[model samples]
Target: MSDLHCPARILLVDQRPAGALAERLSRESLAATYDAPVDLDEVADRHRGETVLVVGPLPAEHAHAGGPVVLVEVDADGRRTSPWDVPR
Candidate 1:
């Protein structure tokens, strides 16, 4: 939904504190919010029929949703990238 046509509902999940990131994304008009200190497994059963975006230093997480489970990664320069950014 970030393409500007429709606003997207983004589930911002992190193991540690990520208030800044969540706040920034929300300002952009996306449904961005933080639900931290939650493991992938625990978050899975709680929310259904929504996209799950996991921002992690470790590997990806196991989640449940009607939509896709996206992996969000940030570089040292603070540039964010995702699986969709990868070239086939």
Candidate 2:
């Protein structure tokens, strides 16, 4: 379960390396980290029970696990070009 007062851990699950995107997010005050889909179990253990906020597309297993997955596009200038919400 997620604790409202505790911030959720952020994960960027992309087909390509998201290092630049992660840096941009940091500049925007949204700190995030990236991990291979296969390393998700380690990530979960690292964060304990805190919710994991995943961005971009994920594998079917994580996609259906009930946490929100935000689809966003950040342009070259670090501006979000496309944004949409996927309801649980």
Candidate 3:
């Protein structure tokens, strides 16, 4: 069985490393998660048209990606904020 409605690109992440997210989502069937170094080159080349859910302290580089990039941040107090929405 497969989720036909699921988007081609879906990513879930937190403060942990990119590799951590990739490894965790490995058990799933649709999405593909990979190691995302500070440079983020791997993610750019591999995942082209996916909505990356970076759910933690988003890296500076990711904030400037060419495609659709989502920056999710959770503070120590456990509050979630959209990083891009905050004042620069």
Root-mean-square deviation (CA) per prediction: 11.9, 11.5, 11.9
- Candidate 1 C-alpha lDDT tens digits along 1-88: 1232222223443343345644433444333334554454344333222334544433334242212223432222322323322111
* Each candidate's clash count: 0, 0, 0
Q: C-alpha displacement of 16 in model 2, angstroms?
A: 4.9
Q: Given candidate 2, what's the lDDT at residue 54?
A: 48
Tell me the TM-score of model 3.
0.28
Task: Order candidates by TM-score, high to low.
Answer: 2, 1, 3
- Tell me the deviation in Å of residue 57 in model 3: 3.2
lDDT of 3 by residue, 7-42 (tens): 233342444434544454344453344444433434
Clashing pairs in 1: none
Clashes of 1: 0
Winner on lDDT between 1 and 3 is 3
Q: Say which prediction, candidate 1 or candidate 3, comes out ahead on TM-score.
A: 1
Candidate 3 residues lying further than 4 Å off, grouped into runs, are 1-30, 34-38, 61-88
Model 2, 1-88: lDDT tens digits are 4333333344444443345554444444333355444455454444442434344466654444333333323222322212223322
lDDT of 3 at 11: 40
